[model samples]
Target: MRRVSEANGLRIWVDGDLRDEATRVDAVARFQTLLGILRAWRSEAGELRDEQRAGLGEGPVCDEAGNQFLSIGPVRTYTTFGGEIEWFAECTRRGVGMSQHLRNALWLNGRLNRTAADFYMIHEYAGVEFGGSLGIRDKLKLSTNSQGRLTRAANNLSPLEGGRHAKQSGEAGMTLDEQRTYVADLLRRWINLHSAA
Candidate 1:
């Protein structure tokens, strides 16, 4: 658990190029807003894993007595625990409706690096589940970009790819909205696709 927690945390590094006071504030505000909006969004739809939440406890948070903060800081800079970075943005793998994909582009690329040339965001899902069993499922893996087409070929490499559409339809058929929602979520989660200055 400690290893996963350490490996999964976001560690943002700045190269001293953070200039312009307003840009810095706007950047900070954007991250702040994204966290707020996403939190509301998650509340409406339900978080992906309540079990994980239970074990991990709330994040970016500390109690005066080391308990719970309820709504913790999403974008924390320096930390006695984690390193300097923008956020501990919680991921939502389920129930994220459509239109979020476009929003993700706007937030991650548009918001995450307001004062710098670029930044890195690290996200880890509990891993994808196809069947009740874990061994032969088509779990999501990271990609170089957010474009779904580019990654589809790679995903097809899995033996499970043979009946994915049918299996997906059988298990949980996404309405067009659900389809777009999960697709967008998957895109945001897997896309290593970063932005430049």
Candidate 2:
């Protein structure tokens, strides 16, 4: 697939919920709960994976017929979405920088008292690196590409006075969208083909 170089003003997006969706639909408390669940699952899932891989001893997780439906399929579908979104929530945010990412969410009174976080974190180093330099624009873009790709929403709202997305370099190109479709399709195919067994 074609990738835009850093030279291209960077229209990159994760296509994850590629989300950041109806901030009005979620609550910060829920995001906190979601984070906890993911943490537990990650530990459990890793154990199962390690057990499966240990047997393979540097081989593929397949036999001559095809793949293991009992093992890989369900685990992956659940684990991936589970882990990645957690990674976003946990890893990619921080500090005074953190509050600013979801600045508009304060104005929103979600029915459920929850809102998708404004920024998705991939790293949580200093406040400025991910939250400041990369900022809201880039977080949504990266979030949209990662776990956000799986979600189905279009709440990239950045139009009010303070509602502005933090300024980061949003990419310029079609790669993010194209790759999202292709990979989503591939994952669907892989699951259908294997799970049927």
Per-residue lDDT tens digits for candidate 1, residues 1-197, read 01146675423333334787866776665554444334323312212244124323444456689874664323323233452112223232221232344244334433321211111111112121212113112334433333232223223322243223322322222222222343335434432121110
Off by over 4 Å in 2: 1-77, 81-83, 101-197
> 103-135, model 2: which lDDT tens digit per residue?
222122111211122211211211243354244
TM-score of each: 0.20, 0.18
- Badly placed stretches (over 4 Å) of model 1 are 1-8, 17-180, 183-197
Output the TM-score of candidate 1: 0.20
Worst 10 residues of 2 by lDDT: 106-115
lDDT of each: 0.31, 0.30
Find the candidate with the highest lDDT and give its number: 1
Tally clashes: model 1: 0
Q: How accurate is candidate 2 locally (lDDT)?
A: 0.30
